[model samples]
Target: MNDLLQHYEIAKKNANKYMRKGQLNAYVDALIEMNHYKKLMKAVIAN
Candidate 1:
């Protein structure tokens, strides 16, 4: 969770240097995926 967030933040910061919107969007999607998985896991564990 933390790692993914950090990676996303770093990627966003450096995304302009690459001038690739798709690449930056990929990272954003990945960050959302990580959040989703984390929540899913938490629910499963609680059950």
Candidate 2:
């Protein structure tokens, strides 16, 4: 769970960085990855 949160934070930062750099594709990928991490975190919390 801790690892998942770390990855989520990293992905969020990467998304912001990519957006600032105008890298649309990379930003979208990072957003998708962030969403995946969020889902996993939710599942962990639910259980």
Candidate 3:
């Protein structure tokens, strides 16, 4: 969880850079997908 959060923070910081260059949408989408995976991990851990 901590590692995932760290990655999220890092990705967020660079997200804007990508957005300005018009290459960030795909990266942003990837981040969202990663978040979903993290949620799934949390759910699995909870069980």
Compare the candidates by lDDT and give the number of the best one.
2
C-alpha lDDT of residue 25 in model 3: 73
TM-score between model 2 and native:
0.98
TM-score for each candidate, following the candidate numbering: 0.51, 0.98, 0.53
lDDT of 1 by residue, 1-47 (tens): 56645655665455553445556666566566556656765666688
RMSD of each: 5.7, 0.3, 3.0
> In terms of TM-score, which candidate is strongest?
2
Q: Give stretches of model 2 more than 4 Å off.
A: none
TM-score of the candidate numbered 1?
0.51
What are the per-residue Cα lDDT tens digits for candidate 2 across 4-47?
A: 99999999999999999999999999999999999999999999
Better of 1 and 2 by TM-score: 2
lDDT by residue (tens digit), candidate 3, 1-47? 67667665666656656677788676677568567757866876798
Off by over 4 Å in 1: 1-22
lDDT of 2 at 18: 100
Cα-based lDDT for every prediction: 0.58, 1.00, 0.69
